[model samples]
Target: MKKVCLLLLSVLVFPLVSSAQENTEPIVLLISLDGFRYDYVARFQPENLSRFIATGVAAKSMMPSFPSKTFPNHYTIATGMKPEHHGLVDNSFYDPEKDQTYGIGKKELVQDGTWYGGTPLWVLAEQNNIKAASYFFVGSEADVQGIRPSYYYAYDGGVSNLTRVTEVFKWLELPQAERPRMITLYFSDMDDVGHRYGPNNEEQLSAALERLDRELGALFEGLKSIDMTINVIVVSDHGMADIPVDNFLNLNELTRNIPGRVVNNGALAHVYLENEKDKKKVIKALEKSAMPIHVTDVDHKENYQDLMYKDRIGDILIIPDRGYYLAWGSALPRIRQNAESLGTEVLGEHGFSPAYKDMHAIFYANGPAFKTGLEIETFQNIHVYPLICKILGLPIPEDIDGKLEVLEPILK
Candidate 1:
């Protein structure tokens, strides 16, 4: 009787063990919907995204990092580190040595290899002999640490959301062996529209989100048809906040004598002074500004230490309160392109500090590798990189700021 019981136990355990192994090796696909707010799906538009939320787990909000801009937040999401740790502070940053500003608009201004200092998930995938692909990301084109994803595309301002989605679908359709073990897809419409028109514009925001929803639906349905057990994680870089016209800060009046370049001038402005004396001058002038602008210098070394780097970032930084934006090049009749004018531009924008609820994005995970329907309470863009590594069964780099948790109730 004892021998019979042992054999029966083996019968049950063998299949379970084999199934676990099979499930552990499933594929991972990470999607970052740029400027996507957490509540847009449930509260505002109940379209395809609404359905997705019902099927997958979601957070009330995915809190973004300080300065909550594109480059810093995206790098935080991919590297699971803060802008302070990952080394990406904003879309355009002041390089003290070069005394010039760098932004995505000019590829030459970016020190791709140096800008991104941490190990991205794709790099970890490659280190573990797994394949990875990036459709678009902060440093996808930069030769960071002498490593690049197996497949990627440069950040193109002209590419439509539909076109970008279609390209990712095509890549997903590759043969089983050729398919990337990990893949990333980015959508920037919602953020684009929200910025120009503000999130309060229901009609325009809904329409833009619906378009992205259709693309997501198509991508999901296509993957399902392939019978692939792909783990899909959807996230956003940062949320958008309203920038009122009355809130625009005048830079020239504030920094008349500061010897530095103004890098970020829209919702936020970065000032890089030439020397310690210049930094002090800029700080004093900024504090006395009538618009109520918040000022931080490099010497603070605590809250503002995140802006410190060898030859990057300015000696002083200026962050505006919620309704204000600072601009360089002297304010013209029309400075930055309004996202609401979707006629010629994308639909959303994100660069404000991640303090308001509107600035929170979505974070969701679904796959055999994840705990199903688990709601994580403690999470940020920093945790994403380490989790991606775990999903691919790779080693988590020690340099990253995010730690691997069980993802709560997410895994089965």
Candidate 2:
């Protein structure tokens, strides 16, 4: 009788200890504000963002990976790998192995997990039995590593910012076991306005920033009402630069005779050659005609050694100088017409080398997990993945580029 009673007591005590451990794990909410430049706070001074920065840890600027485009940087933050390693080299890149192209506009391809490499944070969370939810991060819609967040919405730009915030509250209000320990939220307001009116357009850009700031204030207030420890981290994929209409480089006319396919991605272009011998000819033509643009063959192993799918990077890369837009055929004409109709000489663009200050994004964090009023120097965005994993007590994958030590100092 004594032995049986002891066994029953042990079982009950073990479960209670396990329950306490689970409940003590803090919740992390990762928010992305696309196209938010590093200097926007000093330029516009949005109230909520300002307060958040004042109270929590912030980097001077977050350096985006090379070819600082949307899809690549976001995926890099998600998996803690550079764009080349993650296999999403740009917003749109050609996969020679599959004989196909992947672009943000291609819905079927965007949702296909085969194109993405490395484990996204949501996938890591779910694999560890920690519930995760996403309101539309870059990789959230796809089933990465055969796993999707327990709660997620397909990418829908029409959804109101308030509605997304409301959904997050609903997710948090679930029972302890059902509530997600990790959540991702995204906002693209600044990106939209910046692209339309250019980053220097104070009136339109400030208005958008103010509106988003107000919504963030509301989100912060709502979080205070919850009893759990919730850490909020805000990041942006990349920044925007003003590209004048006169700065458009017509690559189509310049490389018309080249024996390869050129995929233009605004600030950068990728050239895939049909014949290996044609590489020299293609590079020569692009360099001669596109004077300001830089043309290089992909043979430089140091620059491409990390690429898991190197063929997707194309045989040659064409990078325009800062503030210059790379366009081909109808794109140039369409952009010209749009600029003419708008009466604006400048349109915003990115995908420049992160060396350009304007290509850097913002990083701010405030919550129980962070040290208040701490400011750090600029750090690469790749380090964020390990920081998030450390906060929630999730196991960090050994292969990620982000090191926990880099961001660990900011944690309380």
Candidate 3:
């Protein structure tokens, strides 16, 4: 009877203990550098980045979740949930419920709240009554769970790296009483230069990295002058890869008369067919094309179970085989006409799988509260939220898919 009673008591006590562990207090500052790669930090010779990694805990790789595009991965990190769980599976996702498709560029569609459908960390923090702030993030402008951050900036493509950094510094400078409990910032230039010139293009990439480094230096300097107790986390969404001119596959040529819309993401394309039969026909045509593209319906999870689900993907998913690429509509013609045109003419692009090392990004943390000079090898972007929760002394959200590792083993 005594043993049984003790076991019953243990069952009753466990949940309360777990809930108690969720709430605590330390500030978290999160930064995401768009298209920033895992190896580029040290390889590009960025002094600021290198210093941060050396002085803080740098991961081997953040290992982005599937559909490895900017918008999905960004939300994935913010929410600490997989694309399947958080529901933003791609940069541009299809909504079957409303029978519509939405991309980041279409602000009107965003206003409808069809594209995003998860409790982003900022909103989660706000709901918990913790003050949160964001520089810019996908779906951040949209009010999720009716919880907007204490402060946030809208996403603007024209915003320069220097401007973004300066704005972040301004917020960090706020007095302790009014300061946000959490903050997020994003920069996109390095990823821009990298996709155009390839990671090996030292000229453009170096300049971009240098510019980012200087901006980072200024940010660090600002933080130094202000209270240094803030815990800063730097990360990236996905990596980049170069597709050769001869390797390009034109979907228009493959599916000349297929009834569907081609949404291309450089090496990847999503063919949204009007009907199931049309999708099958498109798939058959793509398979018989010059360069093989891995085609799949997002609803069929087996083919792309590792990356994302079919419904969240598209009717016909096109993944260029290895060194090849699938181009749609005018983009295919543009790529064929000029190999350099696709990248150099534009800028950078990322929205591939996270399996490749080149597509991985950096994850590092530094703060007075963090364990000093420690390394965390077994971690993912999902782990980010739990660590932030640890810092702020708050209860981790029940809806959050991320596991709390505390990452104390790496701290000095």
Candidate 4:
């Protein structure tokens, strides 16, 4: 009888132990809705997003790093470092040391790991023996720190959003050991529509928002079938502002006499001088223009908060007012063509100073780890990295700019 009782106890206790072990590890799903503004929830009221806000913690806005463009801010969120520190100073920048230019369209340079700095979250996970997967996120394609996510796909905008959601579900369905503990997903629906139709176009913007929200609803519903505890975080790289076609400033025409190579990214431009002595001449010429703009030298540490890669920032920075866009003469024809195609003179853009509320992005999180119905104040996007590290029980690298204390209260 004693032997039979011991056997029964072992059978029952073994299953309990297995179950506990299977569910003990936490899972985090980080999602990015490109160009999602902070006030989008109140403005559009997408059904799924509204539900997400009510069920989890949210911020009035999430501040992006300077030059609030896609690549820099996305990588900043990943590595918890500013754009200057990460080496991706802008969407397109020239590295004097490498003597090469890095741009979004340049696949060769983008895939090279040497162009990036700071340890990405995926790298941290892989280094610590935790598995990570990314459907599409900046720096996921390039092997930062000589390591990429265990599972990832090269970015292809043609892939359907629903298909991406399906892939995430398949990742989660893997055997416990093979499943990734941290996963990142990206959607450009809002950004795409915003750029083409402008953010103020409610008809087009609302349609995009509704469709993306439905996909989020599907993702949330699919997680219900899984037994493990998972947390979902939704964030955006930056927001959008409308720019009138008449407001487009032709840099080539304005600064033809100025001696420098100007690389313009919509609302901001980096002026690289052929001679260091021309810095004053370039700034004076740029300032002489009657257009509403701010010209500052890269040496002004206050502008960028101590950039690690100052040379890449160029000798001077040119920023336009919120409703104005600075573009090269060569690109003006294309800009006009695009506006004509859309039948509107106004187009949406970002990459301006974050001081403008219009440049702020969104942050929303839901799952077992967050406190429900809690709304927090605006905070920097850099803090997101450490918060994610905390959720996965991973160690935060000392060099990162993010601090855990800022977001720790939201966690249970």
Residue 267, model 1: Cα distance from true site in angstroms: 3.4
Report the lDDT tens digits of candidate 1 across residue range 1-412: 3343234334433333333323225688888887777778775765556666666767767888877787888888878777877777677776655555668687864536776778777777877787788888877778888888888888776787556655665555565567677887787887777766776678888877766777676656545444456888888877776655545567666666667666666656766655667666567767877776787665676765443353565566777776666755366225444432443222234566666777787897766666545466636778777777766778887877777773533655
Q: After TM-score superposition, what is the CA distance of residue 166 in candidate 3 from its true location, in Å?
A: 2.7
Separately for all candidates shown, the number of backbone clashes (residues 3 or more apart, or on different chains) is 16, 0, 20, 0
The runs of at least 3 residues in candidate 4 whose Cα sits more than 4 Å from the true structure, single-residue gaps closed, are 1-22, 303-305
lDDT of 2 at 293: 81
TM-score attained by model 4: 0.93
TM-scores for every predicted model: 0.85, 0.93, 0.84, 0.93
Angstrom error of the Cα, residue 237, model 2: value is 0.7
Candidate 3 residues 261-328, lDDT tens each? Answer: 76645556766777877666666777777666676666665745654334656677777666665566
Model 2 lDDT-worst window of ten: 12-21
Judged by whole-model lDDT over C-alpha atoms, candidate 2 comes out at: 0.86
lDDT of each: 0.68, 0.86, 0.69, 0.86
Please report how far candidate 3 places residue 267 from its true position, in Å. 3.6
- List the candidate 1 regions with Cα displacement exceeding 4 Å: 1-24, 97-100, 109-111, 304-311, 335-350, 406-409
Candidate 3's error at 404, in angstroms?
A: 1.6
